[model samples]
Structure formats: C-alpha cells, structure tokens
Target: MPVQQLRSGDHAFVSYADDDAGREVVTTFTWTGLARHEKVMVFSSPRTDESEVWNSLDAPGPLLGAARERGQLVVSSMRALIHPAPHFTPERQWQRIEEETGRALEEGYRGLRTYIDMHWVADLDADIAVMMHRESHAQHLFTDRPYTEICAYDSRSFAPDVLTAMHRAHPCRLLSRLGELHVEQTPGTVYLAGEADVATREQFLSAVREGLLRTADERRLTLDMSQLIFLSAACAVDLLRLAAASEDHGIRALCHPTGVRILRMAGAENMPNLLLSEVTR
Candidate 1:
C-alpha cells in the first residue's frame, strides 16, 4: 500500500513484512510526498531493517540529497527487531532506546520533515501514543523544526500503562535545577516542565489562565513532577486549582509516583492525566 497522505507535520509510520517494502515507503514518503511536494513533514520509527537503506534511493541520489533538494527532512532508525512482548525492565535497555531515538531525531532530520520507523511491533497503541505525545510535548526532539510527526506500527494490541510510561520517558532533554521553566510546543498540545514552590505555581496558573482566555482553543498541558522532591498541601491545592481553572482548555497535570501519593493525601484523585510508571529504569 502507498503511504498515507499525512499532514505537513504529522508522523508517518511505515510497517511491512519485507525490508524492501518498508524502505520503499520511506523513500516515497520523503522523496515524492515531502521533497517533491514540499508540503509535508515525515517521520519514521527508530527500528528499521535496512542499514544502507538511504543509499539505495538513487532518484534522490542520497537521502540528504532529496532533503536538500526539496527543503525537507527524512528520519529513519537503526536495524532493530523487537518482540511484541519482550521485556523492557532493564534500566540500560530503556536508556539505550531513549538515547538512540533522541540522537536520530536530533541529527538525522535537518529541520525539514521528521520521520520515525520502528523496526519491530511491540504495543501498537502505546508506541503510537508515546510517539504522538513525545513529538508533540518534548521540545529538544527537533532542534529547528517545531512540528511533530509520529508513526507506530503494530501487529497486536495496546497497553495503556506501558504507553503512558513510554510517553513520560520519550527522550527529551531534562530541565535541570529547580524553578527553571521551559515552554514546549508539539502537535496539538503544549507542556510546561519545571520545578516550583507556591509562588511559581501561582505564576504558572496565571499564565495558563491567560493562555486559555487568549486562545479559546483546546490544548493539553502537562506539569511534569518527575523532579519535584518535596510537596506541601498548599502546592497540591494549587495544582488542583490549576486543573480546575483550565478544565475548559483541556489542560491536564502529570506527576511521578511519589507525587501521586502526595496528591492523594492532599485529597486529589489525579487520574487520566497523571502519568504513572510501573518501573522507573
């Protein structure tokens, strides 16, 4: 089947039983759809079967040639065949995957189109959800391009928890030091990852309220509490209030496992948007 007509910044996932077929899809999507048309951004997964795949595309001369010619970007992955139910509990495995995915996104695509192609089929829903969330939420994934394109291939079912954790660990540069703020924009959403006290929380709330008031457009907002080591009842209230204030804007808050217990003690049922992890590797 031909690759789908994806939006300019949409992620395009190409999955096939044959390596040649997968390579062809990537080539067509980058060369014909993006390069030739100059109207779309493409991204594949980090797991592909072909190592010399880029060199095989003669029409584009080189993968970079097509990109330079059309003023777009093409991204692919190293050869990795992962099992659908394979265990990923190892700490190093997760770190390796994150590192590889991060490097691919940063160096392969030079600000044009973004492409990602996973070589194996794990959890379809989780992979796609993670891809969408990361490409849309994390800022450092694309150095110059501010758009997102995430595609996932699946030959099986979906695991919500696994997907959520994957999204949490979707390889973005961590903002070090407490109280530092980072504004991130992704497809269909924006997130603010930082640390803060009561005062900073209030400021964030104000910014969020203004964002909601100023745009009337629905957006998903995530407050990453992965770094927050301490909490107070007042801070919990501030978070809940933030969620309540931005309810109309589709804003949601996320915290780590410890944050969950703290919020619960503070009388908050932080569900749906609270991304919890089974194992922190």
Candidate 2:
C-alpha cells in the first residue's frame, strides 16, 4: 500500500534494496504528510545520503521546500535523534515521540508523520535485543494517536532476523510488488487493499487466516475492504466460510458495492457471523 492510503496512526516497515527505492519511499511519505497538513520528519539512513533524500523531495515542487522553510518539514540525521545521550532507551525515545506528537498537534498540523531509516541501529552499533524490544513496545504509540511512521530498512545491510523482527513489530507494509494483495491489521479491523485474484488466492488466504489467528481472543472481527479493487468468486466464498466457521465472534466486512454484490451472489447472507456492508463513498 502507498503511504497516501495510510491512516493517521499507522506505523509501517518497508525494506528497500537500493537508494532509488529508498528515496521514492521517503519522498512519497513526506509528500503525503505535507499534503495532509501533517508535520513531516525524516531521519535519513546511514546507507542513504541525506542530500539524495532532499533532492528527491525538493524536486517535486516548491511546496516541500516552502514547508521546510516554515519548519513543517524536518530533516535530521539518525544520530541527531538518537545521540547527545549516554544510552539509547526505548522509554526515553518513546517519551520524546509522544512529546513531539503533542507539539505537532498544538502547532496546528493534522498529525505527525515520520520516516526513520532502520540502518541507524547498525551505525550506532546498538544492541539488537534492546532495539527489537523497543520496536515491539513502540506499537503502543500507533494504537491510538495522531502519529504515523515508516521504518525503512536497507535490505542489503540489515540481518534477516532484524528484518523479520521489524515486520512482526509493525502493523503495515507496502503491497508485495506494486499491485498485488496486501493486508493489514489494526486494533479491531483487518484492512484488505489492492486486488486479489486466483493467482493470489493462497497468499490472500494466508493473510486473512493469520489475521484471524492473531485476533482469536476478541469477540468481534472487522474488516475494511474499501481499497480492494477486485476479488475473485473463490476468495469471496472463502471469506464467507471463514466467517461462518468463527461463529462465536461477530464479523463485519466493509467493502465497495461491487464486493457486496459478489458476496451476495455467493450466498453471503446465509453465512453465520458474517455481515457485509457496502461502502458507497
């Protein structure tokens, strides 16, 4: 999914292989933030030169440059946000985040959005265990706040374990390749974005099942499918079956009118625990 589609409190983890991709990721995120009247912050990765990031963002238009002048767009080094202190503590860093978020709101921005390069961990030689703990604990900030963040990692530099940990810690990620199936889970909702067809059915099913498994303790399961462009009949039926099988919890699905029509045609009304609603907007 693109950063433009993310909600105010979303936190995402994106892994990029090269500078070009990394620049694009950060540019889109900051641009969206500025457009939405949100304060934008960028903490450049050790692998990506700060000048390159500025060039990509500044090339778009005079808007980004103007925002920077007004202090709405902030570009800082990894050490700047992390150093000047003896130790890196999650509590202290998180407190700073909360304080900044509040300050952004008071400053009249819609929210505070940031892109942090995960390479800082390696650059600082920070302990992996402590950083991972912080990463997981940081999810609390996204649960309910006007904060959005993207932790972009240099795939070439980060260890596989570190990348995996980041994936599990964050609630969202970009679509697997430009326009395939992507699913995200929030406090009480599972969001399905992009298109899913027979070719992507297995992956789509895995995502849905994983979401259900994660939220099994809850009594209600909600899904937002408004961003889904298409769904195959087989997938529609699979959704109904999953809902029916989980009768103990009430299931709600919000999707485009087309999806509602498809579900109805697939006998969705007969499925237990499943309620399909149309998102006309």
Q: Considering every candidate listed, which one attains the maximal lDDT?
A: 2
Worst 10 residues of 2 by lDDT: 173-182
Q: Against the unseen true structure, what C-alpha lDDT does each candidate score?
A: 0.44, 0.80
Candidate 1 TM-score, C-alpha based: 0.30
Summarize candidate 2's per-residue lDDT along 7-106 as a digit string, tens digits.
7888888888867777776877787888899998898876667677677888855556689888899988656765566567787678778888989999
Q: Which digits, one per residue and each the tens of the lDDT, describe model 1 over residues 130-163?
A: 4445434544433343343434333123355544
- Residue pairs with colliding backbones in model 2 are 1-175
On TM-score, the candidate that comes out on top is: 2
Clashes of each: 17, 1
lDDT accuracy of residue 65 in candidate 2: 68
Residue 218 displacement in candidate 1 (angstroms)? 2.6
| TM-score of every model versus the real structure | 0.30, 0.67
Error of 2 at 155 (Å): 1.8
